[model samples]
Target chain A: MKKFSAVLLVLAFSAAALFADGLSLADQGVFSAGGIVIQNDGVFDPVNGQYSTYGQLLHADHANIFYQIPENSNGHSMVLLHGYGQSRMGWMGTPDGRDGWNDYFLRKGYSTYLVDQPRRGEAGQTSVASAISTEPQELAWFTQFRMGRWPLFNMNSQFPQDEESIDQFFRQMTPDTGNIDFDVIKDAMIEVFDKSGPGILVTHSQGGFPGWTTAAASDNVEAVIAIEPGGVPFPEDKLPEPVDAGYYSVGGIPMSDEDFDALIEKPIIIIYGDYIPEDSDLPAERFWRAGLEMAYEFEDLVNSMGGDCTVIYLPDIGIRGNSHFMFQEKNNMEIADVIYSWLDDRELC
Target chain B: MKKFSAVLLVLAFSAAALFADGLSLADQGVFSAGGIVIQNDGVFDPVNGQYSTYGQLLHADHANIFYQIPENSNGHSMVLLHGYGQSRMGWMGTPDGRDGWNDYFLRKGYSTYLVDQPRRGEAGQTSVASAISTEPQELAWFTQFRMGRWPLFNMNSQFPQDEESIDQFFRQMTPDTGNIDFDVIKDAMIEVFDKSGPGILVTHSQGGFPGWTTAAASDNVEAVIAIEPGGVPFPEDKLPEPVDAGYYSVGGIPMSDEDFDALIEKPIIIIYGDYIPEDSDLPAERFWRAGLEMAYEFEDLVNSMGGDCTVIYLPDIGIRGNSHFMFQEKNNMEIADVIYSWLDDRELC
Candidate 1:
């Protein structure tokens, strides 16, 4: 098992110059939030024989809508993606009944669109085996996200200790019914990308898995903010299964020169937080650190291919004591401010 | 999203009196290791419409052993189950190339048995789905384990900082092939328990899933230390598939009143660390926190059934700065000291 070649965790330096963000200062009429139909196509359920629609067609995935359509609406619209076993609700409210990122972003002035993956949350239905599973017994938020050591080892954790908050967070989660079809997710998201017009995409966790490829699949995508992404394109001719989700291409997937050209200027920022172990004893920590290495390698890959991608490690920048779910942390607003500033510096605002 | 009833993260208290432990300090000759064949059975291969042995029957789950005869051993033995994407190597060596728990436990005088699950590591072939998948991108360790915040927010962490150490940790990881076949894991582990005689079943991460059920399946198991368990019984008639991984019975599954009595005297301790969040903004953190709630409920269930299951939160006891892989951490020896004392308290060591 001691076989792989030695690797390093290097943060690449971006040489691109900053630009003024084109955020509209003028007051506008509509401030709205809604779900975009990522994949509405259907499959030939052999049981049903004839091809049906994705929802009626394949019996998978659903959505919602609400907004002030901000009178001060900036032309910039952002897409919000929840992690595995979750829906759009996560971006709207915290488990502790606090203001979630969705509202923050809305107030931040970006028109936000949230998504529920096929067969989960508002997404109607899908197969059971391929859906997301939090079935793992030992690894969860307490351990995986680094909120704390877990099982209430120390009640002094920064996580909201109130019972009501915990309950609220727990109640909003939704499980997957079948295997995760990354291709389907990409297709759906790309569709949303086209329907919603080119804007910035913000993805978290499992959503980050598809986020990379979806960014590459569409010309409409201006940039991507992958929050704690699960998989980045593994700098390979053929991107990995879950990353490509059986798709022919996505960001980082080796392709014809034309595809690579399309990826140019599609600014991508892979956001990470503190707690990625340098040499912790836990396999979970080690495994996570391994994933981050892939992302770093990806930054190198995308840059080598002439794509614009930057890696933002919050800890490196001075913000500390965050779990994986930093966006919803008590200090999430502060973290968001950091991200917002970066976007402003890059003129993505 | 805030549509749920209030809940709590409760740490159950036990009123049992303390007792002296009976240990054997005799010097034994010839320290050795071997694997226990948990399953040597045949199966019907539906694809071939014929009967075939499970990975050649004799090649079920594998385990290591010590002491010419496990039964003749000095009143102490241990069976170890590694977390997701990990094998027995986790117990023998840290990813950073340090002395791991395997050697420590061996030095502590307990005959240790290490297991590589069916189709995982050295256990040979099994279902493709149940194999390990490194697809999870951001949430596993950095935030989930609690070393610190994620996305490069902070670099100051307690993880080993040497490059060689970091390289060693990344090299040993194995990826999953198909969906995790939890039932297969449970069967293999239970068989090991019966074949090796009752001893302490120590589990980490995903292995904790089968760990709980294996304990329930075999009355031979003297005690269990489920470290930062991901899912406990959910207080349901039949445990959820991902939770129980589709086994007929386990915690959360109802049983005959007589069968419940079999759980008596099963001293179980669920250990956790300090990083689990109190008000994380990420759904990954909340989802994980929810899993802890289930474990808490399971403790309540086991206790009401007369089982001695105590949740040991490390931070609460003044042990902090630990990650999910406490067994392999730099201060693992300290954590082990705590587990060792607990085992001694129960006379299981």
Candidate 2:
């Protein structure tokens, strides 16, 4: 039987090699983050299946937004907001790494949108490269040595210091650059909901902060599925002290516990990594603990605000050795599943 | 407080719009399956920090094997296989969808290999356009006319004839076009293990079939993690005749029950999706029964093979709906946790 199986295996391989004419590993090489270019093609109209307008959102920093129409016209849409320094492609499925939450919801019948957040990806208004090169002696000392070794503490090294820096960095990063106004996302989402009806918002890592803010601002947002939302900026008392150099602390955004409580009123599901300590050497960890804490605090806040909330703490299976980019880890599908189930249970979809 | 909260919400949006550069929804568009391509410039080494001679594997059929230097120098190197018809992208994290399992393992200090399986994605010999146009008329007729209106089965119209057709159909419908060829996936996995030491084979959906087969064929595979595996290929006597196209049947493969028994000897954690019926239009009754039966058959098969098999029947989260692709659905992270917890409990990782 073993021998026969061996022959069968060889035969199968030969057959596969032959019959699989169009298939190749080269195909895998084609689907990269950089290769995925999003083209804006009109608003989604349930009444008609025609897409009229087409263009790409070249963020002021030149980042791209990769979005897709849902497979079903279930009158609901979803926006996938990726974390800091990640591109819109971060939401696309990965071959060997973590696939954020796109596939899970796609399977669940939601028109999904993925965007490379501001100051990240190709659209980055800040250039980590230039920042490292152009720092003052005091800042430059930290930029060169401290930045490389301890990225979490070196904020100036990570993002632009001011509006001028933002412009300089983005101009340096990509030639085709335009600022993606947040209103565009909001307006598009509103249009989708107006046509498809109310929808849900799913966000991961730093993306969660903006997602929550979006939901808080819009009655059209039915629910928010946040995977490790960073920094509960309400009820100042409960909020963590801002990490000196992290992006979460930028723009003098208050991290007060009171602010966190007042910012959200939508049903939220928070999924956190169980295994990894919140304070890893990775720069992203600076906000990881804040995200987890916000998830907890927000749960209470939402309930108090007459909204629903649920939290699922995942096992540290891949967390202990990973960074705050847990959404991009191996066990992410499990995380996706948990979120899917929660949405389903709540009928948020 | 409600009015005050509303005012705060408005301020939050205004602040975000003023401070953060947002993503433009108008410019974001979907890249249909196989429309995007990835370029591999062998820069990052999965093993040591330095780049090595190993280039990306572009299979003859256009599938891909993105080989990273093993992160774990002394630990096992494993293949991170995605489900059918999905590309390596399925492993990356998405905000609103399922999270990939790749990130979990990689972060856990495991050396990983990601491949797009053959006949799916860019590696797919059959293109969606071709699959749709060239489907056997009879099968197409059956699906279009007789099969229920459920989208899950509706996509099955493109499946080729045979026991593996269901697997093939699901793969065809998945968005990632570059799929991992079973033989290439196995070979790459073996190579990684050889370089990085022993490791387990982690697989989801159709990927499970190859993982099981690979472990059974070689002594190098230390363990197996099968998440909602399809195509179990059970014994003829154990299953009903005709067997329906979606369920396992004695088809192209010549492996006998005994052969299956002889092949697998490693510890395996089989995670089954607990699906619940919701809509009346869904074939909930049939699906639930079939899913359970298949799960039972798989548990029995692995245990009979003298392998340490742990079967986890996940809680019926009404949200997974009635779809067979539960692993790819939202809120399924609990399933991932179960797998990880089982591994940790057994000290397998």
Please give the TM-score of chain B in predicted model 2. 0.57
> For candidate 2, lDDT tens digit of each residue in A1-349?
0001112211122100111111011000011111111224333221121111222111021122333343343446676665532344445533222223564565466766555443333222211112111111121112211222211333223222332222111111111112334443343333323333367876765565556556655666787777666544455444444444223442213444443443455667776654224565433334345455545665675677676777655543332322233444455565566666777787766
Candidate 1 segments exceeding 4 Å error = A1-68, A127-141, A152-157, A234-261, B1-349
- Score each candidate by Cα lDDT: 0.52, 0.41
Model 2 chain A: lowest-lDDT 10 consecutive positions? A23-32
In model 2, which regions exceed 4 Å deviation? A1-349, B1-59, B67-74, B95-99, B119-197, B234-242, B245-259, B276-288, B316-332
How would you class the docking of model 2?
A: incorrect
Give the TM-score of chain A in candidate 1.
0.73
For model 1, residues B155-218, the per-residue Cα lDDT tens digits are 3344554533332332233333234566667765665565456688998877877787777778
TM-score for each of the candidates: 0.41, 0.36
DockQ of each candidate's interface versus the true one? 0.01, 0.02
